[model samples]
Target: MKLLFLIVLMYMFDQHKGNRLSNNPRPFEDIKREISDYSEVAKKIINLAVYGKAQNRSYERLALFVDTIGPRLSGSKSLELAIQYMYKALKNDGLENVHLEQVKIPHWERGEESAVMVEPRNHSLAILGLGGSVATPPEGITAEVLVVTSFDELHQRAQEAQGKIVVYNQRYVNYGETVLYRGRGALEAAKVGAKAALIKSITPFSINSPHTGIQSYAVGVPKIPAACISLEDAELIARMSSWGSKVVVTLKMGAKTYPDADSFNTVAEIVGSKYPEQVVLVSGHLDSWDVGQGAMDDGGGAFISWEALSLIKDLGLRPKRTLRLVLWTGEEQGGIGAEQYYKLHKMNISNFDVVMESDEGTFMPSGLAFTGSDEARGIMKEIMKLLKPINITQLFGNGEGTDISYWMKAGVPGASLNDDITKYFWFHHSQGDTMTVQNPMEMNLCAAVWTVVSYVVADMEEKLPV
Candidate 1:
């Protein structure tokens, strides 16, 4: 009886393997037909977005917004004004369910600040104090400089770092890898008893300008003044130190941090025709660094999201799921507004069909970076084929934006616009982020791609599987 049972199990296993191989592959003709079905609607969306008044109108409005409000740092009066402006504009544009959700955000001011080389040479350096940094004493902190390329070098020469200002001369490899020094340089330096920390700006190329970003102090570590210096100055300091020169510097900052300020996450929606509760979200952050016009970093992103809705409405097209737009605040300091929204709306997360964000600059439409199940990926691949005419045929997997990351973690499908980010990091958080970097034709193309992808996904018959 045992031998007979073994023979039967072996036969069943072989048959199951053959069936799996045969059934796993989808037919080419079926995929082609699926793509063909959506081709007409895709052409309509693209034509409306590219040649319609919505794109040009959105560009003009974006110019007015950035010029009038300037840099909308979180907790500033400018950020509040920007939010109010969008609220009124969306309502006037005939969008439904426009409102602001309250959020408490961090407030840090960059007062008069300067850095000067006192020893080895007399040179004034360009600097921007990192957000959340503590103010230096009124007289400023003056000490010899210890230069290191990485945290490992700082640890190896820990004793020498004492009673000195550590300068991180780390070169920029990529934003993700090079930004480590800026984010944690202060904590690492403080752990070794350094008086202050100076980090080289995280950009591959620079023209004697410094880029500022947020930095955090680890618990139980002494807080120290931290700031970013120009790439040229960092390299000069490192070269001088290598020649056995005592590089001494004086740093002064009047940065101040106040209590949390009341802010809001601006929201609007175009109600779905069939499934009113089901949602498809498109978003961008409204707050920016205190420098520049914030055009590329988020102004373009925010305006394009709004344009997607405007184009759809003008074309009289409504998807099956509600299309929502969220302009997040306090994204520069961290994803404060987005995190709060996630916590408040987590119970209804299952109703979210898709969340898409365009934080990266909208130079041109390359494709989309999506994160979902294999079945959903196959569906999106077929959908993206409709966009091949505009050179947006690429579809990457496992990429999502910071604002909607919490929802993605909760099993919601997510996507982010993929563009030619060759020059994005160069002007991202610097004074160079103005409307000059934007081209009218490229911006319109980007909006068209965003609109078509969002509409098709929301109109699909079935939800994206978890």
Candidate 2:
């Protein structure tokens, strides 16, 4: 494979050399000039990000935010304080039009929870109640365990699942496939008269740490206690049951849901010099789950977005269209804050030229996943040429972040920073999500890419075609 790839590369290079030596060489000068025009400013952005290493500031700020405010769960007082911190910080940084937009968010608390193995040997298991799950009775519920690899298996053994604790030992395929059990395992188990559901952490690898995430109960289905157990525990129960050994477990939870609480989406901007009404928006969610410090999952994303605006502002560079930064809340609860923002500002949706989000962890810059028209793609291709020095040149199509999907559906262009996501799922929504997972250089590179993209797009003469 390597030799074939080398041969193909050599052939391509020789073809390029042949074309360059031909008398009828293509007019590549014009394209080079266009790239240079954007590259001039792009160089400065990269320098600022590289030399300044803005990631250090972002990391420190995230550390402080995590230490001081910690776990910005939607509707929690900590989340509210985090919003206030950013609101004041943005204003103090001299960003224009800094303010907060109100959003009501669901408040769910995981009071106390535990799972224990009773039969086959008494042992305690690591567990975390799935967000939005109902509580077990005050004493708890104990039943024999019924393990299934998929919903199909559960259905096949529906009769045996009655009055048992359904254990989903589904193998980790990919996030999109494995997450089905986390999102609907309880509902599926309830349909078969199970007393409770225990899911293997949705991550591909684990260290006896359970990952917790939001789960939704289907309407008209019975609600039951659902939680995640360490991958080891899930496998242990699966093995025991496979040996025809009776495995019984006891589950107890004090989880509760309260009335919706008030929150806000913090907004800041650098008004455009030519067209103030037209906007280029970049954002990341400010809220996270109640587990880790929320550093890698989204703290890095949020701070890098802020750092992009800060870098441009410090350089005194103003785009032709407004550059707006929105720190969203309730994203962990399914993009509640972004949805509200869209509804409130959708009337002027046409004014938005592009929307970009960075929810994926800030590892290293690969490129961007973009969604737009062919004309817009052409424009972006030329613009991305400016990023060649930083090794970011790919332009993927038909991909956008959850928070900006609505805007893209409304005919606005959308983009998301593409990076090395190999380890992202390992730390995502788990206690492993912390500042230790981030690197200063990689985060600065991300900030540089975001700054250049937002600035150039906002300054371009033509709006992205619909």
Candidate 3:
């Protein structure tokens, strides 16, 4: 087999007239000569990068995906439809070994909800129940509002919060910090004897829009009604709190959790011709929030990845390593889809050479990141030479994406296509996370970067280090 592969490599090198090998009269000497033809191979890669820019397949496919799948909040009928849509699309893209990996997912439903500041100002406030938050009693809970700026302040001012709506007027900051308030603020508020809790929206900028994301209830603490108020309303409450004037708030949240449901991760693969055992994986989650058709949060991410692979297949550029794509389910609900997938296919991890993920909101392509050895970092840096035309030079030496972190932990070198995240947090986890958030030209440019880099990784002779 080794002898046959060497002979074929030599024959292809001679046929392509690579470097000095084409001029050599001796066949055996060409084998040694072709070994140093990395420059010729690099040139082909550069040409593909330029070609990718002209193909607008990614934008066309993204529009179609949004039109078909729509919003895909976890466990909703829309999410179920997304599974089917992605499965069919993968099969149509000429990917072999297409199948679903089953996963048990939680079914949290958003029901009726309403909020209003009953005193000082009698106007209804925009509100949405955070995912996993228990609903208020059918009659609802109305109490005085006791606002605090931070968790430390809440603990210090527990006297003011007694039997009142302890409104956490914490300002939104970076995702690493702001997300903590959304995830654990409710549980902390319940630790005290507050009637209920209302949180300021977890976004930096908004036009009277309430953002909702998942929150957890501690094991022994009493679970109370919690909802996010629009930034505009939150500021009003903050002002009233500063004056030491009594603030009354009425919160009616109607969210509930049903029994577990069944879902699947849609998997597709373009098989390798020479080294089929090695795999290069790329993916995005297919599920999104129920509100506003979830076009930016993930629909764009999934479609763009699919489009990149589709371009490679269309170009008839078969790789030496298998290129796999997974449209995942249940990412918004705390990485359930990724965890289930890792467990179901743990054995296959050994064969995975590299895995790339794109979960960031659609923005102009800034660059790529890596989570592997220094050798792999050097290889990625070299590969970027081919991608320089696409404006994708920013590289992180030790970075991993949320969805593919499982693979990286298991030793599969992982990378994420880093998009411009400057404004991502504004609409993330909110009703504003729609397709309208994207600029079509920017999306296409990002897809072009993915196409070139992914193709090079697939076709390269050496495996991604580490």
Clashes of each: 0, 0, 1
lDDT winner, 1 or 3: 1
Off by over 4 Å in 2: 1-35, 53-55
Which of candidates 1 and 3 reaches a greater TM-score? 1
Displacement of residue 350 (Cα, Å) in model 3 is 1.8
lDDT of each: 0.88, 0.88, 0.76
User: lDDT tens string, model 2, 105-187?
Assistant: 89999999999999989999999899999999999999999999999999999999999999999989999899999999999
**Alpha carbon lDDT at 232, candidate 1:** 96
Give a tens-digit lDDT track for model 3, residues 2-82.
999999999987443311122323443342343334345444434443344434456567767777767788888888877
Q: Clashing residue pairs, candidate 3?
A: 370-399
Worst ten-residue run, lDDT, model 1?
A: 15-24
Off by over 4 Å in 1: 1-35
> How does residue 320 of candidate 1 score in lDDT?
75
Give candidate 3's TM-score.
0.88
